[model samples]
Target: MVCESNSTQAAARQLGINPKLLDRGQQAQVVAEVGSEELALDPEIRALYAANKWLAQEFDVLKTALVFFGQLTR
Candidate 1:
């Protein structure tokens, strides 16, 4: 579980798989091939990662709201 922002890429590289394919959710095979090795990031890194994920979800919600309002105006 290499938990860097580029974890998928790193895992793909470590397992000699293509990063592009891995990014498309080819993780199960990668995990099967490499087994699970946990990442050892600091608390700050973990917190930042969690914050980024949350922000992404919030952005999606905002986009949906904009689309909804746009449809209502039309």
Candidate 2:
């Protein structure tokens, strides 16, 4: 996962939340923002972003499935 080290500081300044809480909230906000942007994108650009998001989600799903299967087999 990509980490945004500055988010906590930025969120604290903008939202007046504690740094730790700010970090968590900021991460959620970022995800929401990405989702909103994806939905709002023009059809021409949507395909590119959709493809990228699909690949990343697929990787995450496959990785989690593998881990769960491994645990079940053990």
Candidate 3:
């Protein structure tokens, strides 16, 4: 299936197969071939991205508070 997880007709078309038939046939192969390592990594990658987003939001809030408190000293 070599698609890295994309099973769309466009993926099949790129491989030179007729698009309509490719969908049903390759689906099973793709699922079977996916490694356990990949399955484990997917969640880890998603968690890292989510954590990064949260840290960025928190830093922005802290920055705004710092500015507001600094102004109070004047």
**RMSD per prediction, one decimal?**
11.3, 10.9, 10.8
TM-score of model 3 vs. true structure: 0.40
Which pairs clash in model 2? Answer: none
Flag the better candidate by TM-score, 1 or 3: 1
As a whole number from 0 to 100, the lDDT of residue 34 in candidate 1 is 41
lDDT of 2: 0.65
Cα lDDT computed for each candidate against the true fold: 0.62, 0.65, 0.61
lDDT per residue as tens, model 1, 1-74:
43335887788899898777665464444344344423213445446656887999999888889888895342
Query: Which one wins on TM-score?
Result: 1
Residue ranges of candidate 1 with Cα displaced over 4 Å: 1-39, 71-74
TM-score to native of every candidate shown: 0.42, 0.35, 0.40
Query: On a 0 to 100 scale, what is the lDDT of residue 73 in model 3?
Result: 40
Per-residue lDDT over 15-40 for candidate 2, one digit per residue giving the tens place of the 0 to 100 score: 77767776566456644746764453
Clashes of 2: 0
Pairs with steric clashes in candidate 3 = none
lDDT of 3 by residue, 1-74 (tens): 33334656668668888765675464444344444446424656546656887999999888888889895342
TM-score: which is higher, 1 or 2? 1
